[model samples]
Target: MADEGRRDRCLAAHEAPPVPPEGPVTTRLPRRSFARSATEVAPELLGHILARRLPDGVVLRARIVETEAYDQNDPASHAYRGRTPRVRVMFGPPGHLYVYFTYGMHHCMNVVTGPVGTASAVLLRAAQPLEGMERMSIRRRTDRVRDLCRGPARLAQAFDVDRSLDGADLVRGSEIWIERGPGASAASIRRGPRVGIRVGTDLPWRFWIDGPWVSVSRPAAVLSPR
Candidate 1:
């Protein structure tokens, strides 16, 4: 496995525009689409498009660039505590949002996966703004497009995702939804230890594109030993 240094290194430059989706613009990914376990879904999330439609019909979209997986057996996962009120969504029918307020301030989001009673999810880490840059910047209070959604909390802020969106169906496009975008092969993806966790920190569950400027700036050094 690549060490932390290599895992956290910046990827090669990718300056090209997003490749057109393979089929008709995806409106919503199906419920069964995310029935796989979190580890299996995390890497596959890269290059997908996440969108949220506003009251005025404004649709904001960002291309997912990074993600991390968590499951019930993982000590760091919320579900490890076993079916608490806030974590109940993680045991789901899949393709639903599992949002939580963290640090008593910022909100982070995850896509529920696995079986109905299996708690597993993929935390969206960063994304490349694909549409509605102006609103995203306004919401994020930053003019730097690159920083709009460069972290889990930041992604939630930029997309206006919060507790209100918890358990929202992603397979339905009425509000928030994930659409199929381009797919990246294993050669184009990299894995790393999960971030900002004191437990299960050694699990190499984090995945990201191997060559995309849109990814968050990797830490100068690994924060924890893996």
Candidate 2:
């Protein structure tokens, strides 16, 4: 069919480019980085690179711009009521993905933090696409690069993340991982309350780098450099 042919061509055009012969020269973050509370890891994740590798050898890399922290003590956290089947990964070891479906149509991803048996995670809210723009555009259904991974759901979709990747280990996985990149300066980080949560509305656990790639536009308090 002509329509099918057009669709195939469109997809081919968006296919990721071949990887360099030498392979990706990036340093993966150590698991110890996530062996703390979510609030500690969330702001520090800003500016780090989150990379996803496709089966066909294409790698998509993005710089984290915004994140939200959640822990067992937080009323808005999934672990607040104690561990359940759906949130078991949050109580597992650190440096694992905690992908969850939300709103019946979208998938959001989080990085597990804290010691084993403790529930803590950082929600990756937004990122700036640094590579595989064409592939991400196809997945996100938008040609505008700025809109590709502007929110948690959009970020997951752009990276082809889903429930299947819920327990994937980021520190050791070949498919998806976080790499060390330039960190956001303390003075450049902003803190604010987590979004779209009915409870724990007053705790300023959300953090973001001052950048156009940030998902939300609300003003936040600036942190003084240490």
Task: For residues 43-108, write the lDDT of model 1, one tens digit per residue.
Answer: 888888988876466889988888999999999999998999999889978998999998888999
Model 2 residue 216 CA deviation (Å) reads 1.0
Candidate 2: list runs displaced more than 4 Å. Answer: 1-26
Q: What is the TM-score of each candidate against the true structure?
A: 0.83, 0.88
Among residues 3 or more apart in sequence or in different chains, the pairs in candidate 1 whose N, CA or C atoms overlap within 3 Å are none
lDDT, candidate 1, at 225 = 17
**lDDT value, residue 198 of candidate 2:** 100
User: Positional deviation of 224 in candidate 2, in angstroms?
Assistant: 3.2
lDDT for 82 in candidate 1 is 93
Candidate 2 vs. true structure, TM-score: 0.88
lDDT digits (tens) for residues 36-68 of candidate 2: 989899999998999998757688999999999
Please identify model 1 stretches exceeding 4 Å from their true place.
Answer: 1-27, 211-226
Instruction: Score candidate 1 by lDDT.
Output: 0.78
